[model samples]
Target chain A: MADQLTDDQLADLFAGLRADTVAAVLPPGADAARHTVRRRRQARAAVTGGLAVAAVAGVVGVAVAGTPAAPPAEPTGPLPTADRSALRDLAESVLPPDARSAAAWSFSLGDETSNTAGELPAGSYRMVVACAGDGGTDVLVRWTPRGEDNLFDPERAVVVATGETACAAAPSPATLRFVTPRDGEVMVSVEAVDGAAGRAGFAYRIVPAR
Target chain B: MALTTDLHPPPETTRAVPDFDELYAAHYADLTVQLFAYFGDRQEAQDVVQEAFCRALARWSSVSRYDDPVAWVRRVAWNLAVSRWRRARTALGFLRRQRVAEPQVDGPSPERVALVRALATLPGVQRRAMVLHYLADLTVAEIAQREGVAEGTVKSWLHRGRAALAVQLRPTGTEVSRG
Candidate 1:
């Protein structure tokens, strides 16, 4: 019985248990070393750069030409479903698959400048922006197929963030988009243009599904 | 003043890196054995210890700088084992009553069973103190610091714990030996 064991005996017993515990804990092959990190990096880069753009456009703002030479995306296309939810989900996904959002927040951003850019956090952020009649019913069109600033606005939208360590919000030539490159998180702002007093809005957070 | 956003390497990267392979070779056997003592269930203890270490790897930067990295990991592993024990305790409340009172049970090897039985008898803090003290080769002062108690308190625990263990194994006080 351990109760009857001397301190020396118990110590020896404890030492013996330590050895057995570690061996039993690390079953053979239950290590990350077995997994291929090289392949993972490649796959990550693919989705990070290319797929991220397509996903972001499909998810956040409407693509508009940014050549600074190109004209405004004619407030033409029916303002992306006055309930613009696709755009919100897209913004949130800009974060690397790990950010969540607070109930509400406010950010200072641009609207009709033909682009959205900002240095925001890096995480999964659920962003939703409403240009409700602000700036006389503006259009949230992601005009071009690719998301580029020089092709649209050389300004390269900049987003400076302050909050959770990693808040990912990828920026575009137009409205700021969340980008999840690192694992940190942060909150940011996207000013609504011509927004009637309270219309120009943007929200984000690191919210992951799994 | 403008905020300084200088990006420095994480603490783990900054702290001395351990030779994982060497650590594995040198201490693997001993660490495994000690962890097993914490939880008589060999398989579960192994899993927790391994996972805890992997986590340590993942956050090596933060954990390496800790006052005692190895001790830090042991503590993490210990916490995980405790949580697992709590869960098992709740779920197996009924089955425990019978086997617990008996001199023996029908699971695991005899050595493992005996060790666990003995561990179950010690107070939670004492068990932890004993484990860290013996397994990590930490002294009473270090244990006191880690456990957030005075050296005197640790001595008391060691005294009481050894006495109880002595009675359990060496009923006649002939000093039951383990090695």
Candidate 2:
């Protein structure tokens, strides 16, 4: 009688015998998806981390301290339409000579649907731009220069802000060539919507881009 | 800018959340008791089976499409158990190397440990077939379909694996077969 049981019979007997035992074996179904924004952010940062850095072997005949790595610059505020055109100017000014008038870029800002256009010089690069804000209006810019197109400089300033008038002071039209010496800091003078001239200075400061 | 992606992804992913209740109702105890007999350690086997089942349920949308769910679950459960053994092999190597200038391991030798470890080293399918026969109480025809093999092939391997397991289970005999 013991060995004569068919597979279905055995399965049925197992179901009858161990229903509670099986339930006991199941995992304590905690919400694997539940986490605070802080935990979520922490998880993202852990991805691809702990990679042991290996020194590249090459002979440049002379070697100094290897290229210094810097933390990613924090994102700034949302770029308005005018800020966008200014960003194009910034990217253009920052990109090398061959890449100056000829580079492709992708821009996302405001609530409007957006995309990148124009043939970016060297034909190879990945760039993402957005309005950065703490749920407020702001502009965010991120880009990777690589292969032949890696000539884009990470240090360039295209606009100046003094008081509430941003991008108000443009250099001489003829002097507007791709390169110009950055003369002064973009003095950000934030005040209430209706405030007097040179009251207390802005509560916030925008550091001049390198 | 805050850019958030769903860590749990969409319905099309292997990472989709599980329907834990339904899976529990379906296969929990059968797999646990079965794995317990297979590994001869009920609590550890239960744990490994639970983890593997949770993993399976987490990835059910993808793994459910496999040809043999039982075989799949058993393989995952078995690997989780054997992983401890693979780790333990290094301990054996260290103990062996201690013979360079250390006290001898004296006793009526622990040949049983070597026998069990040797049984574990066989190809997973042969081992599973043997397990289903002895421990799970499944016939050759039952094992054929469960393991997704032809009936004739199942009988052939079961015959061979039985001989091997018998030798491992009993040290003094010249192996026996009954078909």
Which candidate comes out best when scored by lDDT? 1
- Candidate 1 ranges beyond 4 A from true positions: A1-5, A15-167, A171-210, B1-15, B24-29, B65-67, B92-112, B171-179
Q: CA shift at B55, candidate 1, in angstroms? A: 1.2
Query: What's the TM-score of every candidate structure?
Result: 0.47, 0.33
| Fnat, one value per model | 0.29, 0.06
- Candidate 1 lDDT over A117-161, as tens digits, reads 233233334343322122211122112112332212111222222
Query: Candidate 1 - CAPRI tier?
Result: incorrect
For residues A82-122, what per-residue lDDT tens digits would candidate 2 score against the true structure? 64555335423332232232223322222221212122222
Compared with the true structure, the alpha-carbon lDDT of candidate 2 equals 0.35
The best candidate by DockQ is: 1
User: Which portions of model 2 miss their true places by more than 4 Å?
Assistant: A1-210, B1-19, B64-71, B92-126, B133-153, B161-179
Where is the poorest 10-residue window by lDDT in model 1 chain A? A160-169
